[model samples]
Target: MGHGWRTLRRKILTPNVSATYLETRGFRRKDRESQELLEKVGALFLAGYAHAVEASSIADVEARLGTIEHRFRGFAYEGAGMGYGMLDGLPFGHRHHNDDFLAGPAADQIYIVYCGIGWAMARLPRFRWPKAESLDPLLRWLVLDGYGFHQAYFHTRRYVHEHYQAPRFPWPDDESRAYANRAIDQGIGRALWFVGCTDVAEVARLVRTYPAARHGDLWAGVGLASTYACGASRDELVRLTELAGEHRPQLAQGSAFAAEARVKAGLWIPETDSATKILCGQDAETAARISVEMRPEHVRNGALPSYELWRQRIAEELMSLGGVSK
Candidate 1:
């Protein structure tokens, strides 16, 4: 059913990979570029990931990642889109990372790199259970949520896990993490519709029930699933965004932000842009616009995914922005 629905979604929602199709979703495409540069970087990462995963040692994976860390060091994958990308460069490992790959010594600030690794660690596991398992789930949550997404991403391998020892945040009125976390996970691709289909007030009330730090992630997930997966109408998108923004503007902005980048790149399946746009908002738009020029000439580039190339493009764009740091 999941596989079949995925197919139907592409046909119905993505029907085409052009600006016209995107316009239906309120994504006004402002650009295009050669697929060349995107492929080269993708190839490099794929090679890196393939080798990293094959190794028996976590040390080997980090060693392989060390060679390519510089490429994405500045790529923005934080906030609502935290850990959505970088799965290709960071395979799971048994022990915590060996900080040598980073430009400087590791600190909590260096969580960006760990966040990238953690994202790959979390999202990629659904592909083959226990196959690439390395990083501890709690630790992965720690690094990914080092900024505060654990509210939504926390879970046990078979069910949700509890953290009795971690610092605690007050829950909203009477809401509990158990109720919210399970709902968000179950709502993965359908929460937005579920709120209306089920009970808007209950869902909205639930969103407001959690502490701000964690609830933002739940709201962000709702915003993303509601906006992108449901093929929401412009009015619906606006309403959903408004609802999510009320609790978490960063999460509400995700779908549009991702949609804008994917539309510009002509990608039906986006990468970090899916959620990064939620947190970065207009900053994502500006970076995506600049990414077009980053595309190499078709004749010169080969075998890479255009979406990955956009990160390099945005990295360059952000450098020019002068005030913001991802």
Candidate 2:
């Protein structure tokens, strides 16, 4: 999938490659409406790109941007769209993970990156998932909600193990890097909590229970319960509550901040800082160092997956091929 994604990125980003791929695939030219719509979406993404960050602090928005891309990729798998482009580097109306905004940049890049995820979503009928209908609101919700923190989180293997880990994928040793960790395990667990905290279900239920609690308490109540059920310790749960506060601001920091706090303050015994770094787009080596330093026991015990070597190899290949650039 990664290799295929790299190919897709090059094909989409390089006009010559794009033409060649289209020719090889016998693809037709996209109509003007499609092109114009793509442009409009790009404009929207650019407009919100700076403020798109949910966290108050950014060492590099690009790092957090990688987190958003990671989260959006997970969202793509779970029968929904994050309303962004493919994280595999296929640009479409999608905002770059980096903070610097260049002037007079090509809008095509923005649209392609931002809308790349939507493009993938459009291909989902072949995968037995429902087609996305007008992803505008969905995408807005995703970025605004801090890249669906809970959704990205639910895809982790630990969540699945806590729920249905036995006899399934990602055995104890492979738990951290299992394929299922990023999709089924993490997505479902996080979705439940995220939905529980918002009025999503209530709003859906409101169609039946008109004049009922308008997505406020009901969502938060369910989110709280889901958080607890997902093995969050009492202190951790309180911390989540504190971050959420009263209004539960539609921002991303609560989750990122909480993750940082848990590890730094020794609140929750995390899987590894490397795993968290992966969420933030750190290369494998950096992630490993952070992980080992943060949790020596996990590293010595072989609890953390050793993907750094493979990641490095892939990164080298990507750099050689110009599939990735600084």
Model 2 scores a TM of 0.24
Candidate 2 positional error at 184, Å = 4.9
Candidate 2, 1-326: lDDT as tens digits: 25455345434432232222222322222444323332332233332232222223223323434443321221111111122222222333334322122111212122122222423332333242112222222121122122222322323233212333324432122333232222222223233443222223321232123122222222232232232123333344334433433323211111222233233322332422322222223333343333234331222112233322222333344234331233
Q: Rate the local accuracy (lDDT) of all candidates.
A: 0.34, 0.28
Model 1, position 211, has a per-residue lDDT of 51
How many clashes (backbone atoms < 3 Å, residues ≥3 apart in a chain or on different chains) does model 2 have?
28
lDDT of 2: 0.28
RMSD of each: 16.4, 19.0
lDDT of 2 at 42: 27
Tell me each candidate's TM-score: 0.31, 0.24
| Clash counts for the predictions, in order | 8, 28
| Model 2 regions more than 4 Å off | 1-179, 182-184, 198-326
